[model samples]
Target: MPHFHFHSVRLVKALLACAMLLASYAGAAEKLANVTILATGGTIAGSGASSTTTVGYTAATVGVERLIAAVPELAKVAQVKGEQVFQIASENMSDAYWLTLAKRVNVLLAQPDVDGIVITHGTDTLEETAYFLNLTVKSKKPVVLVGAMRPGTALSADGPINLYNAVLLAASQDAVGKGVLVAMNDQIHGARDVSKTNTSTPDSFKTPELGMLGYIQGNKPYFYHVSTRKHTADTEFDVSKIDTLPQVDIVYGYANVNPVALNALVAAGAKGIIHAGVGDGSLAAKVTPSLTAARKQGVLIVRASRVGQGIVARNGEANDDELDFVAADTLNPQKARILLMLALTRTSDSKQIQRMFYSY
Candidate 1:
């Protein structure tokens, strides 16, 4: 009887092993999240004259297919497809391109097969584009923007790892409802707050005020905070019908600053002027008259600090109320310009525009 019991136990163990093997096979066959890589060209696609050379290299030379092919590991993470929306150095990124990209993102997110999106962009204007999408994209699916500080052909080039992390983040279920994300150097930052702090480095992007949303470790994303700011489906800005954004210009403030740039912008029919002030969004006493004149001409004036960090307090440093101008809150000048363009589409009232600045 004991011998019979032992044989029965061995049979049960064999059956259990077969069941586990079948389960493992089924798990491996599960469909991965479909991530669409919208390559807009950047240093990530740039090719240097030599592997040793980093600077003075040709940019936007590589295409989307090549970028995808460079990262074969992506196939294990998610099903990724590449689409070249346009290829240019990010410095040339324009409002029309912004509109086109935002519209495409919306259309793809609406598709049942598409789970998320990854945008390859140049580091120069990456933050601006990210912020624009953060305000305009009206979906809960993940939208990740990535760029490399080094050219794709350089030694230890950062593009592959950054691109891989971007795909990983885009495919993550935790990335949903996080607004638009900027992934660089294994750090995940929200679009509204992240900016390029370093001129040339892999760890350039950072959220100075609120900090990063999370980081990627061991090929897995871990989140510490969700952005409290309104974004994605919760945002008021809509790009579905927006073919063109209003003209907005940025003027840099300095000691003995002349108003020529500001005046030129007004003459050029600028709908809004973003004053990149010295500190706390302060304008030089000499430049205030030009700004006031611009405001009188029905040009919306927004005070944004050139300083990399800290918020530009409303009514404290800049007389926003008296000049009928809006304070940029925490937005830098470039990002402030993006917001002003979208805000102009809704209302030109300084009070109403200020409310938009505070809220968005």
Candidate 2:
């Protein structure tokens, strides 16, 4: 009888132990994380004539709290905090806004509890903002930027879903050290390559040549690769110390190109200019004199092809050898402008800036 009683006690002890183990497993399985959101005014914050309306819109209409409350499912992924950094329409966004946003991002990434960040931005200049962030923010932590094509009040709008996916990707451990990211249409893309391809389509944001790094599946982010570009919260590209970048302009090129625009920019004190030349970024014969005068005045000039792909040759039939101007290697003219301004922030030396055009 004593032996049987002892066996019963041991069985009870084992059952209690199993219950405790199961409880602990349940707790550990939870993906608890901390994330911060820096909201800038965009379509994500806009509203319409009615609470249920999603079409008609106004900028910076709704606050970050409303955006956060709109999607409660975020709690399942991370403990999120909201900070309204700016409440202006993205269309009104400018370099001042970019510098402000970059500084704020630098501050948030410095916090230890902050695992990631999500920014709501406008669609019009989303590419420019994304590229700026990609080049500046030095943190390796996931920085995801998202926006909506429709008002937050709409019935079939894309903001809620986009914000949800962005938060998920931002909180995921797999997303760290991958540079800044933009998530839209359920796709995750690197900041440098992603651009808006369609205006109003739900699947508008796209990354060309290179595809998305990964995708959000089953409400989770699955990234299979990483970008070779530099990024994160390291504060490598400080904004305050490097202000007053040279005035660089892009001049379009077509048949019968005129030198008037180039001459005007030089007169307007343009420190550098990018000629959107034809074919391999070659300028028309008529524009040669204007380019020469601009270069002679020490206005750094770069020739870039209007063609959608490939690098522009330095020694082309465009008479680049005599001009002493640098030719961009495959950078689109607009991208060339961004790179040029950023490079010029550090140095005005044409040779050093030329190296930047090639590397970045």
The best candidate by lDDT is: 1
Worst 10 residues of 1 by lDDT: 23-32
For model 2, residues 1-360, the per-residue Cα lDDT tens digits are 999999999999999999999989777655466888888988889888876665457868889999999999988888899999889888787777788888888788889888899999887777778878877886878889999888887778889999999999999888888888899889899876677778677788887766788899898888876766555553245674654556889899999888888888889989889998888887788998888888898888899877766768767745555677888876677677777777777777777777776556
lDDT to native, each model: 0.93, 0.81
How many residue pairs clash in model 2?
10
Q: Candidate 2, 65: how far from true, in Å?
A: 1.1
Report the Cα lDDT for candidate 2: 0.81
So what's the TM-score on candidate 2? 0.87
Q: Tell me the deviation in Å of residue 230 in model 1.
A: 0.6
User: Estimated TM-score per prediction?
Assistant: 0.94, 0.87
RMSD after CA superposition, every candidate: 2.1, 3.0
